[model samples]
Target chain A: MKISARNKLDGEIEAVDLGAVMASIKIKVEDPGVLTALITKESAEGLGLKKGDKVSAIIKSTEIIVGKE
Target chain B: MKISARNKLDGEIEAVDLGAVMASIKIKVEDPGVLTALITKESAEGLGLKKGDKVSAIIKSTEIIVGKE
Candidate 1:
């Protein structure tokens, strides 16, 4: 599936190993304990998203929540 | 953080219990093996996203990957 044009959130992105070809992306917010991410089985064959590699998290607005403290 | 506009993808949405107040949103695609999701530590108190809740999976272009079989 091809995804284009979506909301972007500025946060620290980190990749975590999920065994085999699956991996998880971690988005660290500045609010201390808030964390978000997009998990996929899409392997990082050539994308070069390593454990410590930095990347931008692209989020769709519909996937986000507001007014939560 | 407030998000208003973004791209959305149609998929089967399900909420999984992640212990405590944290929960995981599962996006089931038609491809069967390809599962994707946006994990948020944000609780589902008033959002009403239950285990069988039906919702759409919003995705951002930058978070998508192409060319893999």
Candidate 2:
């Protein structure tokens, strides 16, 4: 899909934590950092997410605060 | 700061485009992905963000729908 957002990380699923209404999916990208994505439990189940699965962690936010110190 | 959201990407600022009330910040992370952030123009100014600045692209969304094909 052609998303307006430019950040698209091709990553491998490392872990999937599902809660009652929310789910957290950890993806291991090419870098050393692990990207965590929070989505609805229903969507997570619908996606059939599992470890070793390849997915794209697409992030599109309007409130990405830029911080510097 | 300890944010509830888990996805934190350490990146360097590549470009900053400010509009009337909103702004777009492009950041280059360690991986081969360029993260784009959209924030308020006031907040962007408050952050004093500029090119070559190091920042963290924090993404917190409760509706991060997971997609698969």
CA lDDT, every prediction?
0.53, 0.77
Give model 2's DockQ, 2 decimals. Answer: 0.58
lDDT for each residue of candidate 2 in B1-69, tens digit (9 for 90 to 100): 676865667889999999999888898888756777888888889889899998987766553445555
Compared with the true structure, what per-residue lDDT tens digits does model 1 show for residues B12-65? 655454433334566665565334453544644456666656566665565554
Candidate 1 CAPRI grade: incorrect
Worst 10 residues of 1 chain A by lDDT: A33-42
After superposition, the stretches of candidate 1 with alpha carbons farther than 4 Å from their true spots are A1-69, B1-6, B20-22, B32-34
Local lDDT at A57 for model 1: 68
Of the true interface contacts, the fraction found in model 1 is 0.00
Which runs in model 2 stand beyond 4 Å of their true positions? B61-63
TM-score of 2: 0.85
lDDT of 1 at A35: 53
Best by TM-score: 2
Please give the DockQ score of every candidate, comma-separated: 0.05, 0.58
| Distance from true location, Cα of B46 in model 2, Å | 1.4
